[model samples]
Structures are given as structure tokens and as C-alpha cells.
Target: MNDLQWYRLYSDSEPIVEKELLNKLLSNGALAKFALVRHNGEYKAMLYVNGKRINGPALPEPLTTPNGEVTHWMGNKPGVGLTTSEAEMIIQAVTDRIERAR
Candidate 1:
């Protein structure tokens, strides 16, 4: 997947907040800045540049909760919402969902 492409979204309405989110995620190497354009009224999720979405929002389960959130795998700690086996299942689910949605 070395040839992987990236996707990103930004809106002036959320400058401060979006910038903070981008900074935090970037530090962890999950994504990077690719393009910045005006999309004032468009709500878009960053889709796969190759037209494929990642296997999961795979968002951390606890983070998916109210306001508590954490990203990244710490030493031996895996983030919420996925275990080794669960990740495989999520991978399948994500692919299935995206395929149907598209």
C-alpha cells in the first residue's frame, strides 16, 4: 500500500477546530494535508483517493462514547472497538458497507 493516496476535508467554518484535529491526527501519522479548497456548504467524509474507503472508521470505542477519546495503540494497549479478531471482522464490515453505499 505504499502507493496509497489520501483524502482530507476542511471548512473555513471550522478553522480553529479543524486545524486542531488535523494537527493531532497528523502527529500520529494517520493522515496528512493534501489539498485545501473552499467547500462552504459541502459535508464530506474523506474517502479513499482510489475510490476505496478504509476498512473501518475503526474509531476507538471509548472515543466513540460521549466525550472521552483516545487514538493510537499504546505499548500493549489496543484502542477500543477492536481486538485482533474484531479488527478482521471490522475490515470485512467496512468493505461491505462502503461497497453497498457506493
Candidate 2:
């Protein structure tokens, strides 16, 4: 068993948004395949990609449903995150490598 790398994501959106973000990250090699795990109402999405565990970012805002209904309660502090440009840089680098490899 290997320890997963932890990434903290902050957003004022629904879990589905977080999930979508995770999916994007996975497709971009920022993450691998993952599992959605919940404990005490806290959702922890984990994945092992390239011998690294990429833990999905946590949601900071309350999660709402597609109908705009609140589904889950987010914590008071959603915390800060790396700039989008920084994340995109990583994504692009990985995507480039993947493209070249393919």
C-alpha cells in the first residue's frame, strides 16, 4: 500500500462540481482512477496513478443538487488553493507528455 498525495481544492459549488473537477484532473493525469469514500459525512476521493495517490480536492461550499437544492453541508472554511494557472500548467505538462507518448 502506498500513501496518496493530497490536494486541497476550494470551491463554492456542489460535490458534483468537485467530482467533475476530479474527473478532469484524472483525465489530465493530475489524478488516476479514484474511489469516492465517505466517513462522518466527509467525502474523501482517492486515486492511485503512476504510483501516486491523488486525493481529490475537498469541497468548501455546501453541495447543491442539479435542481439547485442543498444536498450536503460544507465546512465553515473551504481553505485556499493554488492559482488556476498553476494547476493548468501542471495539466498541460502532463497532457503534452501523454500526447507525445500516444
Candidate 3:
């Protein structure tokens, strides 16, 4: 089963951990305002704004990796990514989570 737990987003120098807040941000303006960070092979959030860090709220876990990140991997397949339909489903799942939180 492909199970998606939750998404923790980063925006330039902002950290958005709440699904409701993400929707609020999107509702307030365009999607360009947020810059999401990718993890493993998925999108997560981390912010860097004008050389400053903004903590929007408390998240289930720290935004930074607790034990640091790996420098090398064998199956990364740099050029490979999800198919159009796969990506669309994930986006829809994320959107559903945000809507459910509202």
C-alpha cells in the first residue's frame, strides 16, 4: 500500500508543519510564495528567507534531519521521477489532507 502520512513544508525562511496553515497560505496568495524541499523522493518543506529562519509552528519532529543526511546513495536514479499520474495522485492526496484539516 502507498500510504502518505503528512507533509511538513518549508518556504524560503519559513517552516509550515500544519496542513491547515499550508492551505491558509495558499488561499492568501499564489503558490510561488512557498518553496518546498524534496526528501528521499518526495517533497517536504524548509525555508530560507533573506538570510533568516522563521519557525511558523511546532511540528511533530524537527525540520532538520536528526542524524544528518546521507552523502551517497546507490539507487538514486537522479533523472528518474514519478510518472504524471503518480504525481497527480500524490498532489491530490496532499490536497485532500489539507481540506480535511479545514
The best candidate in terms of lDDT: 2
Candidate 2 lDDT over residue span 14-35, tens digit each: 2321232232233244433333
**Could you tell me the C-alpha RMSD of candidate 3 in Å?**
17.4
TM-score of each prediction: 0.24, 0.26, 0.25
Candidate 1 residue lDDT tens string, 39-60:
3333222212222232223222
Q: Which parts of model 2 are misplaced by more than 4 Å?
A: 1-54, 57-80
User: Which candidate order results from sorting by TM-score in descending order?
Assistant: 2, 3, 1
Evaluate all candidate structures by whole-model CA lDDT and list the values in order: 0.28, 0.34, 0.30
